[model samples]
Target: MNEYFIDTNIFMYAAGKPHEFKEPCVSLLSRIQSGELKAAIDTEVFLEILYRYHHINLPDKGADLAWSMMDLGLNVLPVTKKDIEISLYFYQQYQDRGVLPRDIIHAATMVQNGLETIVSVDKHFDIIEEVKRIAPSDLI
Candidate 1:
C-alpha cells in the first residue's frame, strides 16, 4: 500500500454534495479507507479545506468532514517550527517565480512529514520535486 499526502481540494470535492467530481472522489477516498493508500493531511490543508467549504456555505459540514477524515485514519500531520522555516525558505525561493503561500505550505508539509506522493489535482504540487504529484486519475 502506498501512502499519500492528500490535498485540500480532494477532500473538498469528496465531501461536497452535488459535486460533478463525486465518483472520482469516492473512489480515491475508498482507496484510503481500504488501506490500499494511506492519506495524510496537515493543518495547512485542513485550514484550506475548511475555508473553501465555508466560503461555499458549508462551514459546519466542513468541520464535520474533517472529523470524519480523522475517523477514517487519515492522519493529521502537525506543523512544527522546522516546517515553518522550511516553508519560509520555499516561499522566498519561489516568490519571484510566483508560487503562492498556500502551495509553499503544502510543499513544506509534504516534505516535513516525509510523504513521498501528493494526491492532488493542483498543478502547484508539481513545483516541488521532494514529493511526487499524483493526480486523482493517477490513482486509477
Candidate 2:
C-alpha cells in the first residue's frame, strides 16, 4: 500500500516503442492497473505524456492513453498555487545543478503531497533530497 509519485518519463516509456526500459515500465504499470500498488501523478506529468504523444503525431493515441491512465485508477494530483511557489524555490535552488523547470515542478508536487518516492528514470529527480527516484527495472 505504498504510495509513489510517478514521473513523466515512466509513462512515456510505458507508451513508447520498444526499448530496454519498456518491459519494466509496462510491468510496473500493470501492477498499478491491478491494484497491487498505489501511484499518483501531477497534472504536469499527465500533460507531458499527452504532449509527447501529440508531438509524435498521435493525438488520438494521446487521448486514449490519458483515458487509460485514468481507467487504471491513477490519481491525478492538481498543480496548485503552493506547488508553483515551491517549484520556483526549487528552480532557483537547482537550476544551476542541471534540473529543468518541469522537473522542479514535479519535485514540488511530490513534496506538497508528502510523497518521498518517485518512479522515474530521470536522474534529475535525484538532485532533490526529498525524492527518491527509482527506475522501473528496479521495481521489476
Off by over 4 Å in 1: 17-20
lDDT of 1 by residue, 1-140 (tens): 66788888787788767666666777898888877877888888778877877998988987898777776678888888888899999988888776689878878888887788888887876777666887787786
Cα lDDT tens digits for candidate 2, 1-140:
78888887777788889998889999999988888889999888778878888898998998888887887788889999999999999899999999999888889998999988999888877888778998888776
Model 1: lDDT to the true structure: 0.80
Largest TM-score belongs to which candidate? Answer: 2
The C-alpha stretches of model 2 lying farther than 4 A from their native spots are none
Candidate 1, residue 128: Cα displacement in angstroms equals 2.1
Give the root-mean-square deviation of each candidate in angstroms. 1.9, 1.1
